[model samples]
Target chain A: MSNLVFLPILIPLLAGAVTLALWRSSRWQKRVSVISTLVYLIASVMLAQTVSEQGHIVLQVGGWQAPFGISLVADFLATIMIVVTAVVAFCAVLYSLVSTPGTHIKFGYFPLLHLLLAGVSGAFLTGDLFNLFVWFEVMLLASFGLLTLGGERAQMEGAIKYVTINLFSSALFLSAIGLLYGSVGTLNMADLAVKLQDVEQQGLVNAIALMFMVSFSIKAGAFPFFFWLPASYHTPIIAVSAVFAGLLTKVGVYALYRMFSLVFTGDIEFTHEILLWVGVLTMLSGVLGAASQFEIRRILSFHIISQIGYMILALAIFTPAAIAGGVFYLFHHIIVKTNLFLIAGLTQMLQGTYELKQMGSLYRQRPWLAALFLIPAMSLAGLPPLSGFFAKFLVIEAGITSQQWIATGVALFVGLLTLYSMIKIWAEAFWKAQPEASGKDISLPLLGVIPVALMAAMTLIIGLYAEPFIQLSQATGEQLLTPATYIQAVLGGQP
Target chain B: MSALMAVAIGILFAASLYMMLRRSIVKLVMGLILLSNAANLVIFTSAGLTSGAPPLLDKVTKEAPVGVADPLAQALILTAIVIAFGVLAFSVVLIHRAHEVVQTDDLDQMKDTDQ
Candidate 1:
């Protein structure tokens, strides 16, 4: 049971290898990838269940001691993330089977998907900062492969920008880890949690913390560092974009949440203050960017930046309730954002264009598509009786309690702007009576609709039955706030 | 000696940043290489300057050698260098492919998606 953490990382890695071996046989690749993700889903659920009931589970690779060897630790926060990764990865693979062109599958799309899952899992579970960097590289390489799979001109352009920026971030991440290891003399996170408290060189520590902040902010698609995101995110195949938007930036947020909570809490006043302003700019600019875009995917790409702002705002506040709100938002945004991209893809399939001016009759021709799209889109806009409303409400409540009035105001304004852009999408794409041209084709199989509908159903389920999810996030947030428990578990309760 | 390596790392970082700011995609790849090597050098120097002594422990007494280098830093750098090499290789190929498709190396002209 305690070995479940390793299973999530291992299954995808093994499946990726299998898929690569069977790449010539697309049938085998699909079978292998789907079964592997299903197995991962089951394992992650078991891991989450065990962590919820039992405490954090820690495994030192090769039976080495915690500080000396690589450690894989599954705390509540990590387990929930792994579970979410499993669910999203499952939907993404199913959608890829129908949406990804045959040329892409030949280029090893399934294998790359599994490799990305392995990377996300590794990032969530590693107890050492260096190990985290390795997992990031794993994810970067795999995403690069997927980004350029089809070899299209637009995809290559997007891939070039994406690759350049991400590689630069990787360099930054490495340098930060090196400096941190030099200053603290250890890379194990739990050990750093204790070691950093004893260091009196406050300025140096804070400088290194800022380095981490910038690196992660870029990854999270936050403001002042989000130019690459909107430039490139829309160029990929829908399955690729859906998974990337859902899980990639969230990994960045999770890293921020982890480091700030565990190791970099020495000078929260300075570090988190910077984070707060970043949140404000990111939210305002991201939504404003969305409003100005005419392409459907372009709008959603910008919203990814905007939504990242909300999570950072919660993190900047750094209260337990605020962190809980951030966690809830993270889960909600992954499902809703991914579903939006999937719907946009299906819309392109049926409506014959990605431009808002040319798109129409989606609701009239396929009311069911409109309904499915509405659930997540409105949820994204924080409409009542949907998941997004509760997510934004919790964060705003936390802000109000903490007297963060300006940020609270900004958060509310962003929600309204979010609704405006979503309505823009609704009116332009769905509610419009018809386009000027009558020759537009709307032929799409129901196979591609399954993943979108499934994600929408999840949004509805979580929105209506919000209690259990809220409790889980609260528990996850509680675990994040109290780093001592994590340290104790990883270090065998050693002082 | 370690201070000298630190100076070199700083120089490398500055050079790479300048290169990365250029318009040419190939130069951008060069910058990425230099930047990654700079990071690896930082890791190497951070473990301190060692006089190339063996890090092995004696079987007879199980005592570690004096002035021996910390092998851990070397190990970390080795891993980083490998990862960087993989990324750099992929990046070069990506640049080449992108150049083939778009027919230009200037990143400014690659503005098809923003509109």
Candidate 2:
């Protein structure tokens, strides 16, 4: 059963390699990509079930011991993340079949996309710090390819900033790993958790934690470190941007969750306090930034940053309930945000532009699309009986219970501002009269609409039936709050 | 030796940051290369400056070796170097392509995406 832990990573890798070999046949590439992601989704569900039944699945690669070799450990948090990733990847690939240009597909877009998934899964599963770094690089390289695949002028401009900032972050991550390894002789996360407790240089450990915080902050698009995200995310194809928006920053948040909960707990006052403020500011700045943007994708890009703040706030609060809320928020946000992007792509297909000013009469032309848009859009704004409402409710409730009044207030304010932006889009893109000069409407493809509708249905399901999901998130939070189980599982009876 | 290496790494980092702050995209790439190299050096220096026998076990005794330099640091640095090299290659090609399409090397001029 432990072997199943590797399936999510392996399936995507093999799919990527096979798709690369089928480069000349875009038809086959599309089939291989979609089938593999479906398989991955199945594997992820199986892994999640296995994890639920048997606390954690730990696989030490090549039969090496934990401290000396890389380990893949899938706790509840990891399993949930893997499942969500597979869901998003499957939807993105399905949407891509009709959305991505044939030229991009011929140029290895599917392969890169699969590789990116592989990297994301690897990062989630790896129990070694350096292995995580390696996975980050893998994801980065594949994303760079995906970003610049079309080589459009705007893409080139965005890619430059994206590439530079990510490269810098990777360097900082590596340096932190080196310094950490210097202080403590192991890179395996479980071993580090054990060793970090005994290291006499507490201040040095705090400093190193800050290094990691900054690096991940950049990756997660926290308040001051988020410029690169908005600059690049909107430049990619909608399918590409959708997956990136859903998975990429969340990976950083995942890392922060893993590290802060497991290893960096020594100086919680010093580190998490900083994170608390960072999260608050990130929420404020992100919402304000979105309120000012008229471009649909750009607005959503800023919203990603803002929502990231909520997750980070949950992590910063660092209670079991808060973590649970963060987990629920993470899952809900991914589906809703990705669905929103897919809907934006549909509008672009119909209106021939992502600019809100150029899009209009969508409500009348395609009422179904408008309704689909409203499902995710209203869910995003935390409307009742929706996934976003429950997600936000849990987080805010956790915040109040934790006595984080300012954060709770800001969160409520951000929700209002979020609604304002959604309404702005509603007014400009869906409700307003059609501009006379806008291009002729292109019919929305069924394939593209399927992913959007499916995801919207998922949002409704999660919202309407919140008990099981909340329980699962609570379980994930318990697992995260208690790292001893993780260490014991990975180390295998060795104290 | 450790102090000297620390100074050298600091200088490398400073130089890279300076290069990266320039307006030219080409120079930014150069800074990235330097930054990665400096990071690799940080790992190398931090792992201690021991000059000892190879970290291998004796064939007969299996564990008789002593005073062996740490092999793990070198392995880590090697991996980092390889990954960095691949990234640098990609960035180089990306910059070349950007120069062709966007028709400017000035980083500040590539603000069209923001608008």
Worst 10 residues of 2 chain A by lDDT: A435-444
lDDT of 1 by residue, B1-115 (tens): 9878989999999999999999999999999999999999888888777885869997889999678888888899999999999999999999999999999999899888767
Candidate 1 displacement at residue A366 in angstroms: 0.7
Model 1 chain A weakest lDDT span, ten residues long = A433-442
Model 1 agreement with the true structure over A1-495: per-residue lDDT tens digits: 667779999999999999999979999999998899999999998898888888799989988888989999999888888988999999888888788888889888899999999999999999999999999999989999988888888898888888888888888889888888888789999999999999999999998999898899989989899998998888889889999999999999999999999999998999999999999899999999998998999999999999999999999999999999999999999999999999999988876678999988778888888999999999999998899988999899999999999999999999999999999999988998765756656577666888888899999998999999998888888889999999999999578
DockQ of each: 0.81, 0.92
lDDT of candidate 1 at residue A392, scale 0 to 100: 96
Per-residue lDDT, model 2, residue B31, is: 98
- Over 4 Å off in model 1, which ranges? A437-443
**Which residue pairs does candidate 2 place in steric collision?**
none
